[model samples]
Target: MCGIVGYIGKNEIKEILLNGLKELEYRGYDSAGIAVLQDRELSTFKAVGKIINLENKLKDFSTQGFGIGIGHTRWATHGKPTEANAHPHIAEFSNVVHNGIIENYQEIKEMLQAKGHHFLSQTDTEVIVHLFEENLKNCDDSFKAFKKTIDTIKGAYAILLISKKDSTKIFYAKNGSPLIIARGEGGIYFASSDAPLIGLAQEVVYLEDGDIGFMQEGDFDKLQNIQPLNINKSFAQKDGYRYFMEKEIYEQHSVLLETMMGRVSEDRIALENLDRDFFEGIESITICACGTSYHSAMVGKYLLERFAKIRVNVVIASEFRYADFVIKENELFITISQSGETADTLEALKLVKKHHLKTLAICNVDNSSIVRESDRVILTRVGIEKGVASTKAFASQVLVLWMLGVFIAQEKKLINAQEIKEQAQAMLKATKATKVDSKLHERIKRLSKRYLHGHGFFFIGRDVFFPLALEGALKLKEISYLHAEGYASGEMKHGPIALADSHLFTIALMPEHLLFEKIKSNIEELSARDATICVISSQECEVADDMIFIPKASSYMEEFFSMMVALQILALEIAIKLGNDVDMPRNLAKSVTVE
Candidate 1:
């Protein structure tokens, strides 16, 4: 995956592109590069490393004025992160920047090479410029040339192309990767991630798969399958934060608010835009996802089964595609993905489609391909998450999933609207009480060495903590590289207790609810096993060993907010102590766009 930004505005093109790169650098730090059209040609600067490395090289270089430009921060899929693999991959006549993989690049590259198209970088993106060049020779216009090039592409790509002959204009296309265009005071702006232009533009028009966007000096429009698609100006708010990750974390509050925002005061809680009949007809839910999104699926399963009384199965997307499992038409298959283009999840979706099951996608980006492919879509309005390692997006997904369960319960006549509202309000209050300890760094530094006792972790909760446990274990493993495990509190004795010893670290998600004592006993049993107990519970549950208390709230929702703050603190602490890249962990990209 990569972060790409394009500009056709009144300001100096290089400055805007460079600044935007700095903002989007969290997506990928492997390398950075920019291309700007000037003096009848594309001028480029590229370097392998952080965006800062690219900036250093550009200190003496000059490419200026209101012209079309594109920038990229790459996470290598085609080639190693090196100068030779950097973006703004330029040919003699065209410059291209890409955000996703070109799966068949080798074959295409060999074909182009045989045709005497000389290559430069070791990137699949370089193949696109070659294809575009070949297409330009035959096409009558620029948009057609771009479309023809797109038609020839074999894999996912959201690309920006600037031609030397047409410096006044730029062409872009998207397929299985994100690309959004927005109007600015000067002109049009494009970004793979939304944060770069949050303050610059309030209105945005997202580019769908197979859609091409063209922007000239003062105007831009979109074309879907070579036909114009109406562009709408939908306002997106930043809500004020220096970093999008921080804003996203706090948006957990809004996610709770929106999920419980309006309607539903009767004995039955009302769910907007949800198909009650879909739930009624389904006997099972197979929730599938990858990475942080997978953790969300695990959490969703716990909520669905506990409250809605439905059988739920959680599967990793990559594994689900290969597993020999029968998918009945009556089963409801759910997929969770923050970026709807996650490679394995998309592949899994294709697998589920073959089964003729009722499908649903829970995602942050609306109208994403997965949402389009699914039978029903539940949009998590969690705004742009910029940091590579998800914080807010994951939290919001959990909150929405919880609401979904409550809605399903109500639809099934299991829970009341008053119950949903009370739980929702508790979640909001927890958000307010959820304090990011300013002294966390120092506290985490000291707590680092002490975590080794936890050879494995047991996360226990009753209603929602089942998935919360899985999520906690996932966080411990993702950055900390800890061999952590999560299971229901009652199920601990089944098989996991064999691992509980003095060296074991028990994480009890004991919210102040009906199952508090049950969770406390699980922690006590682990404690008796001589394990170190770390309780992530409500303020009411007074525990002695390493207790991180959360605010008291309704049982239905406290687990989510409590889980967020505790997990964040634990993740940062573990990463810092383990000397891991908390933001960009090894071999893990923010969005798994490539399968």
Candidate 2:
């Protein structure tokens, strides 16, 4: 998961490249660099951590040229986050910025070293520029040399190559990694994702695997009718909020509407991309995803099994990649990813595609890798989630999955019209119920500090709420850098309750409509041991040390939507109390585009 941005135009290159990289900073921020070609000379600047460091290095640097440049923000796959290992790796002939793994780099490095070539850094990416440099000796054209270098490499990569020999063009190639070319105001721009291209470019092309091409100085303006990227510049701003995470956390109300607009209604969930009979006779479903998406899949498993009356399996995409799945005769494969370019999930999608299974993707980005690879798709219109910790995307994913499950149940005649109508009304109510207001925010902010002193936090629930517990604990751990665990409330006495004490915080999700008493006794069990309990529920739990009561939801689905938003706010407040970067948490990128 690295950010790669390049430009070739008449505008000033540094600011354009830097701004594009800033949009893609959620992809990575371990280290960053840029290689800008000016007046027939290539200049390279490197920084050890964060794009800001690179920006500082280029503060006083001056340049005069046609504005051809390539920049990188690294998530460091092959080497440590060091200046020596940063991207825009330069050799004698060509400089390169690459994403994805070079699986056969050691062997290739040895081959190149034997030919009297020397290496500079402990990175697999260094091999690409050096290989291109070596290939230039055999080919008259730099683009041909770049192609030969790509042909020789055996791994995943979205590569941008430039050379001192040809400052008028920016050559690119993609294989098993994300790379898109956007025709914008000045010229053609390249970014690993749509985040950078949006607002900057109107038309864009998502380059496919095995695609190789170059944008020459005089050639990009001819074809002007390509599909325009759905650009919303507001997604990149925090408005008056302190951080994007906070803005997104409060955006759930409108986000629910955005996700349901045109696609979800009272009588139907319009996923017409899948054939009418697609869900017919589907004995089971396999949902593959990672991180927050994986947690959403867990919730989906509960919904799909409860509503659709089908066996549902939620597999972590990273593990699913290597596992030998038991694919059934009438099984459906669904994958979830906000970026749709998550490397493990995309690889898993490709892996299952080999078995000829019908695939559906629930994603936010329109043309992400997962969306392109799937047989059918559902777009979660939560807008661009700039926060690396993921606020609105998770809410939208879970909501979309719920709608899909209920729709399938109706389509299969598993639920009657009365039941379907009730489900739809409950969803409509959820859009209003799942709102977080100033009262709850203030309440959460007031108590957010009490949680910071805990040794660890336990987010406990039962049945479907078990996954919400996991997600709650994950959010706390991700943003606050605190130790937290999510466990079934029933399993407290099994062994974990021994760790419960005043120093321990338990954020119990005890919904009034769903197993409230069952989870209440579990909370009481933890209370007996003097665990600091922050109860988030619609019921008054006398055993809780603190409470953030939500509006009583009408149904199980509504309960989840409301409680889910509450948990997200709780985590955001807690992280803010600890003075953590709420938007970009440490060592965590927004999109896990690499394993």
Candidate 3:
């Protein structure tokens, strides 16, 4: 994910743009740049690191008076994180800063090149500004030219465009990615999220999908929906913790409470946001998601099939977009995203909507693109998730998905009122059981020291735990920069056991119930192959070199919740021991706006 900030006002554009970028640091970026229109002259400056580097480069430069400028913090989707690959790309008269990938940039670039357009940078974003300038020739007005460009492009984007020919206005368009325009005292502003717009404006308007408009002299035409900025700067702060990831991990208790507030009761799963008829005719469910959300979908597949007696399919969002679907008339399509702007997931939802399918969205942010485009939405109640490596969001999604399984079961008359009550009570108990006691945390920290030196890791499990194994391996690979793989325990004996050695660390998720003896046998087989084993279970393992104990969960659903906390804490401790930035790991963004 990248960040976009624009201003057209009386304040110093340099300071406004720089401070705006600083506020967006938590979103994660490698390169940053700005283009300011002063005295009808567009001056562009760029740097290859943090906002401080950009500030240093602009130390001697001056933006004279009431200037319109657009700034961007780039995460290097299409090219390396260099000055040439930064944003605020300029072409002749038009300048653009973009978030999200431009899938058709190569084709568009070749078309522009055939027309004698010379490009300077290796970025899909450069194509956008060039296309805008090229369209100006045929269109009668700037507005038409901007609209034409938006229509021509075919990818996710939140664009901020300005022209040397007209200093009076700043143009914008948002497709799948996030872009919010705030009306400030001096001028109008634009940003990817409310992070930069928090202090500048109390009320902001979120640019809807396919929105193309302009802001001129503190006013513009694109005010479709305005809402109060509910969160403050304090929400973005790390508080006392050294990193936002740790703070978010510790906040799981409250986040789960927020997630389960109105939806879960003693005997029912009522989604107030969705109508009762949403699942009336649905016989099957198709869930599409990416990364951590995709893991939740896998668990959901098991939950829905086992508890609800419904046919469920889990597909990766990227693959689902290209695959032909055999959509049943009674099928319900569900999309999951932490930040509802995940490009692959959002686009997959749009592609499914083309089939006239009934769609439901499970997302954290209210009114995100996925939430807006889908027929129904269930918010995960995970407020501003700032960490690039997801923690709380992943846990909340599984919790919500489990509850959805219960809801579908009730709808199908497969589960009785008493069973629903048991499920609800178990959910509450599972959430409480997820808390990491100080002693367990201390043991995890000590064990992480040895784990920090492993050549590689294998997280092995079975059935529902298979997805948790994948999530655990992903967490390790993401934050610790380790080469780890997750596998179904049974699959290892076929071929992967060949790689097992003394240096290979295996984290075995063995619950007390639900095929416990079978999974324990899988662990013993791995141990016999000389793989170091760390077993997370309620029972003592005879073959374990190390073990982390959890309460004896009553159901697989509860084990799913508690095991997530164990894996997350282990990953966090290992990353911290290695002196890595767990929140913003290398080459990773909070949200993947690019496919």
**Considering every candidate listed, which one attains the maximal TM-score?**
2
- Residues 306-397, candidate 1, lDDT per residue (tens digit)? 77898988899998888887777678888999878787898799787987888888887765678878888877665556556777677767
Give the residue spans of candidate 2 off by over 4 A: 221-225
- In model 3, the runs with Cα more than 4 Å from the true position are 61-65, 107-116, 134-141, 220-222
* Per-residue alpha-carbon lDDT of candidate 3 for residues 1-595, written as tens digits (9 for 90 to 100): 7999999888889988998988877778899999999878888999998788889999988765688999999998788899988988999977899998888899999999999999988889899999988999887699899898999999788999999877778998888789988876767888888788877877788888788888888464437667777765775778897788888877887888889998899979987666557778788999999999999999889988988888999999999888876778888999999888888898888887888889999999886788889888888887788888888899889888888888878877888999999999989987887676778778888889989886899999999899999999999999999989999999988998999999999999998777899998888888998899999988899999998888787887677777888899899999999999888788888878888
Error of 3 at 137 (Å): 5.5
Clashes of each: 3, 0, 0
Candidates in order have lDDT scores of 0.73, 0.86, 0.87
Q: What pairs collide in candidate 1?
A: 453-503, 454-505, 502-530
Ten-residue segment with the worst summed lDDT in candidate 1?
A: 226-235
In terms of lDDT, the best-performing candidate is: 3
After superposing candidate 1 on the true structure, give the runs of residues whose Cα lies further than 4 Å from its correct spot: 135-145, 218-251, 263-266, 275-280, 350-357, 415-449, 452-463, 479-505, 511-531, 538-545, 551-560, 574-587
lDDT at 497 for candidate 2? 96
- Encode model 2's per-residue lDDT on 39-133: one tens digit a residue: 78888999987778888999998656576899999877777899989988998866899988898899999999999988889999999999988
